[model samples]
Target: MFTVLPAAGGYTMSENTKVIARIRRLMALGTRNSNPHEAARAVALAQRLMQRHGLTPDMLSLHDIQESVCQNLTSNAEKVPAWLSSLATVVCMATGCRCWFGWHIHTSCSGVKSVRRSLHFYGFSGRAEVALYIYTVLQRQLRADTDGQIAGYRKRRILKNTLRRRADQFREGWVSGVWQVLQSFAPSECENSMLQRWLAQRHTGDTLGNVNVRAAGKCRGDRAARVAGWLAGRDTEVHQGLTGAQAQQQITAGGCTHE
Candidate 1:
């Protein structure tokens, strides 16, 4: 996690930083293990070290310092979908982040303007990057799963009309099921407090808004599509190497925002 370099002039890594890095590395390895006993032991060791040092995960993971806001996870549409908001909620819960959907105005070289939908995240610097990575992975998986479901329904002649509505239902169900999967990973009280402070300091004047999704009407194929989507969402998995070079570089980057 934290690499030590010999002092070129007068600077050197602190002992506390070294210990936190080791703890983070251990925690990352523990979470990535397939064997339950080994994983438990690794995490336990990490926790013990943290206790001895009076350190928390936020300190070990560098979340207690350097918060940032990341944005421009574009949906490439004029109107944002309700499922995207739901997906953002799931990502926020899993990563200890906050998310909002907004629009971006862009002009082409020919002077044509367009409105594009985008997603934004606010949290510790690493949290936003992690949120972006998870969102990208899950969004791709959800789209692929929904496309497969729609194609299967077409082949079976089960979906003759209301295709858009049916797709929305499936996506909504998928987000719900994914939320169930990640519900237990919510942030700790300390981390939540830090997030609240960040929001209060950064978004003090921001307006509260909501995404409006039309309610789905009763129909025959609605249940089937939603069930399929729920099943797919349950099967979706996300594995991130938090200590990898790419992630480390991004986490330590100079820019405050990911763009």
Candidate 2:
């Protein structure tokens, strides 16, 4: 005969699992290693590649970042922060690249006043930064090469297609969609709702629609401005990692509502 368990235990740690083990061996020390030297060496390759791709222009800073993280994180006798190992494993399987973003997110994703925890939960926000960098650089390259049309062809519009209330658009729901990508790169992390969704219900602009509506307020052009404020207010580290262009892209991709 078998026995029934209470809450649950031993779920597979796949891209799907958000929190594999709260009691992870190294919930804190992590893989970076406390000495800092060894952990830096392990992730050096990843940092270099990101820098080369313009993900990091201040090349030296990348080195320092590695060292700092490892120094604080690694431990000779203690288990490495399971978060790092899990993140590293996912990077190898999916991106086939090192955990450049993973490392970046580990240290940078902080300051979530209302959200709780940090963005380090997933890798895609870093990837989002990378993608935006790629998108911007490509845009610049295109402008120099062929006509604007050529650049347009290579460009991806992150703009929304009206309110994302429909099922088809819903599948590409900004929060869920981006969340899915980020989770693939990082260890199990809690998902974030698109700030706009919350702001729409919370922020109000010029007295056009509801005049003084709070929480999902009506708006004119100021809606975009308000959303911008929300993102900036949410997390500066994440804000720093992303380019202004990406900000516009994410807004356009899903920042409007007809209702």
* Model 2 regions lying over 4 Å from their true place: 1-124, 147-192, 198-259
Q: Which candidate number would show the highest lDDT if scored against the true structure?
A: 1
Listed per model in order, the count of residue pairs whose N, CA or C atoms clash below 3 Å is 0, 17
Q: What C-alpha lDDT, on a 0 to 100 scale, does residue 162 get in candidate 2?
A: 24
Residues 31-61, model 1: lDDT tens digits: 8999999989989998999899887654443
For model 2 the local lDDT of residue 19 reads 22
Question: What TM-score fits each model?
Answer: 0.57, 0.17
lDDT of 2 by residue, 1-259 (tens): 0111112222221111122121122222235368676555545644454444443322221111110012122212122222223323332223212222111122335744221111111122233334333223322332232232223333554233322112112111222222222223211211123222222222233111211111222323234433332332222222343333443343222111110
Q: What is candidate 1's CA lDDT for residue 211? A: 58
Per TM-score, the best of the predicted structures is 1
